[model samples]
Target chain A: MKLTLRVWRQKNADAPGAMAAYEVDGVSPDMSFLEMLDTLNEDLIVQGEDPVAFDHDCREGICGACSLVINGDAHGPERTTACQLHMRSFRDGDTIDVEPWRAAAFPVVRDLVVDRTALDRIIQSGGYVTAPTGSAPDAHAVAVPKPDADHAFVHAECIGCGACVAACPNGSASLFTAAKVNHLNVLPQGAPERESRVLDMVAQMDAEGFGGCTLAGECATACPKGIPLQAITTMNKEWLRAARTSKR
Target chain B: MSWTSCGWPPYGRRMALATRDRRPPTVRTLWDSSVGKKTVMAVTGLIMLGYLVAHMAGNLKIFFGADEFNGYAHWLRHLGAPVLHSHWALWIVRVGLVVSVVLHGVCAFQLSRRDIKARPVRYAHTKARTSYATRTMRWGGVILALFVVWHLLDLTTLTVNENAQAGHPYENVVATFSTWYGNVVYIVAMLALGLHIRHGFWSAAQTLGVGSAARARLLKGAANLLAAGLTIGFISVPVAVMTGVVN
Candidate 1:
């Protein structure tokens, strides 16, 4: 398949970026989106032209490292990470637009890579359960109910991909923050620091200059992990409860 | 279990002296957070929503003719008269409503600016966002604000209302709705109000942390009901006048 790619390119973080079109010939339909990019990059290297820069690691869709707004969708037209998105999803001779995640908190670092360290700072604020630094405890030591464990696991799927922020018109990180909060807040082991976990993480999220949740559900739509929008409501509930009851 | 539930940071509390030196997070500090601002919007919006329901119900009194409508208007000023002075209860409600409106508008303005700033750049390929009512909320709010001004001038102050007279609210309402521009403005604003409430009511519930997947359908149904009921109820007055049913 020969296709036209309008890929965003920038020299560095301080440099301006624009869509630079490149034509790739003989692209196989079985190649992943990143592999297709590899094809284009090889040709660019052969011609001594600077190849487009993007983020990718693990390439298995779990690292949350690949951040691309392909064809206006977070990962692509499909519901998976960019690395897992195959070229078969597109028609032959199609034109694709590739760009970085758009959010002030997740500013574009170069091409399709945005600094998502803001999310790490939010997790630092409290996204954890308290345990002494030692060897792992017995799995059955703490008995969490089945429903609660399911709830925790459901939300724990968030990969910190920042697609929620990219898809959100407000560029809000509510879904990301909610997933982190709910993943731990539902477990028996997590019950100890539940209140502070919510409060501090939410405060950190706000401090990072991320936008507020408007409940538009775009975040959930773009999320590759299928983190439910209800995660946000749960976070809101936790935050409110903490605000009212937690001594802090 | 967690640091003896002192609400202090457990790791820091290991010092035993840190508890005395550290300040706990309070509602005061929380208010400065974006979440708190949203709470303010949610609360104020519910206040206004409640008032709109009552306002629409009161407007329905027009169907009972000038006596019931005029009597209801008169009763408003005399509300709580035995204990509270004449117009005192009315003034209190007026003040409360003013406060609600001001706070709601201020928070909406600030949050909107922040929301826009958070997403500084736009994607090259854009897609339409959310529902029409959801996307149009900001402009709908602005339109409602301007409409409130016209409504007050036409009804409350008896200014801009050409055929206005004192103490005859039924007649004044009829006169206001009697004109072409009046009907046009009233209908348009009422439509905007419906769209606003459709999104705003559900959004307020989410912001207040009362919404969940289980309650989502119920809350949405209520929002639609309220939006439809109020719009139709309020627009009935202008329709009544235009059709010479009230006049």
Candidate 2:
């Protein structure tokens, strides 16, 4: 098989980049997307040319490190991470355009690597259990309702890929941040730090320069973990309540 | 200066609370942020709707004759509890209305900006999945904002093109509506306002957790009815005046 690639090339964060075209032959349909890229890189190395720089680890896709906006859709159109995307999804001789997630907060670290440390900052803002961090309470002590526990589990599956941010028109991470907020905020253990958790996470999200949510539901559609959009609704409700009741 | 120097000796011993920064998430998490804005949008939107209803009802009083209509206006200004002048009440209402409008607009603007920044590139398949009005709400909002300013200047402050002259307020309304250009402006603005209100009314309800199937149906019906009623009521004032039916 043959494929034409228009891949973004940048030397470093300060360098200007554009799509550079390449052609690879003898590609196999069975190769995963990254496997195909590996084949292309092998050829470039033999030819004494710089190999295309991309990010991927645990090509099985759970790491959330394989971030790419392929053919104009984040993580391609497979509803999964870029690492999980298979070459069979594309036709031979097709031209694939690859670019990094374009967001001010998630600056491009290299060709495809972005500094998602802001996401860590957002998480560190209060997405945690503050119950003295030392002793474990009995699991049965907290009596979490079945539905709430199920919802918390759903939000907890987020891999922090920033795909929601990339897919959003406002470059907003409400979906990602809300998932984290809702995950912890819903649990019995997270109750003690609820007010402070929401406040810190929200502040960190804004300080990182993300836009507010418009509730388009695209972030949910693009999510690899299938995080629900309702988490945002929950966050908004909590924020309003916090603002009104915290007059003291 | 020592913390205790001002008179409260324990001021220095007081600890600063480690308050968390709690701004709502950008529209990326629209569902989460939906609660606060939903409340604001719902409450404020309802207030604005109430104002519109009262305003139209007041305008309708013109059919009763100048003395009756003036008396109606005067009564609104004077007939409240404890004989509070309606103007004072009106001013208070106006302030509340303005606050609501600001909150609604601010929430929407923040959400829209986040949406724009989230996906800088236009989606290739957006047309198939999204409604035209939903997609264009941001631009429509800007138009409505501009329209609101012009509307206030024309009706409230009588500042239409700086040609506001002293005369009967109703006569000024009649003269303005009688002109072909004025009718055009009013009609255009009213149409946009109708579209803006159409989506907003029910959506605001939905945002504030009004998602029961029956409640959804009720809200939807009410929104359409309100939109249609307001459009026709406001438009009728201009139409009746222009056709010389009021005279």
Candidate 3:
């Protein structure tokens, strides 16, 4: 397959950027999206030009490291991570536009590489359980209801990919924060710090200059894991509940 | 692994408690949070939505006839009589609505500004991502706000109504709707109002955390129904006057 690419190129975070077009030939249909980029990069390196820089890890789509807004959709047209999206999804002669995630909270580091430490900051605020660390506990020691376990498992599917923020017109991180907050808030082990977890993480998100959610449902659509939008509603409920009842 | 063996997770519960110790949790009140501001927007939007329903119902009373409509108008002024002063109940309702409108508009404006600022760079390929009603919310809101001003001036103050009279609201309404520009502005504003409510109601439900997977469909349907009903109810008055059904 031969295709034209309108890839965004920037020298650094402080430098300006523009759409630099390139043509690639001899692309295999079985190659993943990143491998196609690898073909482009190999040609650029041979030509003594700076190749595009992006993030990718675990090429399996679970690490949440790969980030790209291809043709205006996060991770291209596929509902999976960029690394997991194959070249066959695109037709030959297609002109694909690739750019990094757009959000004040996630500033671009270089071409198609934006800093997502803001998400780490949010998790740091509160996204964990204070469980005792020792020998393995009995499986039946903690009895989690079936429904609650399902809720936790579903929310835990979030890969922290930042696709939600990239696709959101408002650049809101409500879904990501919601996923982290609800993943643990419903579990018996997570009960001790549940209230503080939501309150602090939400506050941290606000501090990161991310926009507020307007329920446009874009984030959930861009999500690779198919995390439901109702995750945000649950987070909002938890926040309100915490604000009302939390003592310290 | 080291973080675990060091006795506790460095970025977990201890961080939350340490921050709370340094500053009282109340120091960052609900108003300071994005979620909290949305609560304010949701509550105020609901208030305005309620008023629109009441206002549309009252507008329908014009179909009954001039005397009955005028009597209904008079009755509103003297509402809560023997205990409350004349126009007092009316004044109270008006003031509450004004507050609701102010808060709703302010929150919308602030949230929109932040939304724009959050994404300074635009995508190279511009694709329409959301629904028309969702995209036009900010502009539709502005149009509705300007229409509210014109509406109050034309009907309440008798400033823009043609050949105005103070006592007869039924006649004043007819005179206002009789003109072409009046019909044009009223109809356009009602359409904008419809679009606004179509998204606003459902959005408010999500912000307040009342909507869920089971009820999202219900809330969306209800929003559409309410938007259509209010727009038709209010626009019917002008249509009736123009068609000679109410004169």
Candidate 4:
């Protein structure tokens, strides 16, 4: 297959970025999207030109490291990560436009590589339980209701790929934050710091300059992990409860 | 080791508590974020929706005749009688509605501005993942705002109603709807209102955390019913006047 690629290229954080077009031939349908990019990079390197910079660690979808907005949809048309999206999703002679995640909080580090440290900061603010290291507790020691446990496990699947932030019109991280909040807050061990967890994480999310959730729900749709939109509502309820009931 | 065993609190918890001390009161903090603004919009929107339901029921009194319609309007002022002065209850409701409207409008405006600021660069090829009503919320809100002013001027203040008399609400309603422009304005606004309510109610339920997987379908159904009911109810008054069923 032959394809035309419009990929955003930036030298560094301070450099201005623009869509640079490249044409590559002999692309295999079996190749992954990143593999296709690797082909282009190899061709560029052979010509003594600069290679395109993109972030990818584990080629598997679970790493959440591969972030790309393919044809304006985050991760691609499929509800899966960009790394998992095969070239067959596109037809031969197709023109693909790839861009980095665009959010005020997520600055471009290089071509198609935006700094997602904003998400890390939100996690650092209080996306954890205070359980100490020791002998592992009996699995049955904490009997979480089946429904709650199922809900928490579903939320715990969020990979933090920043696709939700990318797909959101408002660029809100509510879905991401909600996933972390609900994941920990629903469990028995997570209850001790529940009130403070929501408050601190929410405050940090706001400080990061991400837009508010309008319940637009695009984030959930774009999420590669299939994180439910209800995660956000759960977090909102948690925040309301904390704001009302917290002593401080 | 546990955080306490180290003779210190966890770093994140310590920072959170420290920040809480420097932060403003809970109410102010809640008002400062996008989530906070959304909560205000959802709560106030529900309040206005409540009024719409009641107002629609009152407007239906017109179907019974002038005496009943006029009586219903009169009863509004005399509500809470014997315990409170005449019009006191009405005034309280009016004030509450006004406050809710103001908060709803201000929050929506600020949140939109913030949304725009969040995305400075436009996407090369954008795909919409939301519904049409959700996209039209901002413009729908503007139309509703304009309609409210016109509605009050024509009905509440009697400033735009050509045949408006000081104390005859039923007659005033009939007179206004009898004109072509009145029906046009009312119908257009009602359409916008229908779209607004359909999206607003569902959005409010999500914001208020009133829907779960089990109840999601029911909440959405209720939102649709409310939107359709209120739109038809409000539009029926003008349609009846236009057809000379009520004069």
RMSD (Å) per prediction: 3.5, 7.4, 2.7, 2.6
lDDT of 3 by residue, B74-182 (tens): 9999999979999999999999999998988887888888889998999998799799889989999999999999999999999988778999899899999889999
Worst 10 residues of 3 chain A by lDDT: A124-133
TM for every model, in the order presented, reads 0.94, 0.77, 0.96, 0.94
Against the native chain B, each candidate's TM-score is 0.90, 0.78, 0.90, 0.91
Best by TM-score: 3
Compute the lDDT for candidate 3: 0.90
- Which candidate leads the pack in lDDT? 3
What TM-score does candidate 2 reach?
0.77
Please list the residue runs of candidate 4 whose C-alpha ends up more than 4 Å from where it truly belongs after superposition: A134-141, B1-24
Model 1 interface DockQ? 0.47
Tell me which of candidates 2 and 3 scores higher on DockQ. 3
Model 2 chain A: lowest-lDDT 10 consecutive positions? A239-248
Model 4 residue B27 CA deviation (Å) reads 1.8
DockQ of each: 0.47, 0.20, 0.61, 0.53
lDDT for each residue of candidate 1 in A9-71, tens digit (9 for 90 to 100): 887889998998999998998999999999999999999998888999999999999999998
Model 2 residue A69 distance off true place after TM-score fit, in angstroms = 1.6
True contacts kept of each: 0.59, 0.22, 0.68, 0.58
Which sections of candidate 2 miss by over 4 Å? A24-31, A87-93, A131-141, A246-248, B1-46, B53-82, B99-131, B157-174, B198-247
Candidate 1 local accuracy as lDDT?
0.88
Model 1: residue B195 alpha-carbon error in angstroms: 1.1
Residue B33 C-alpha lDDT in model 1 = 68
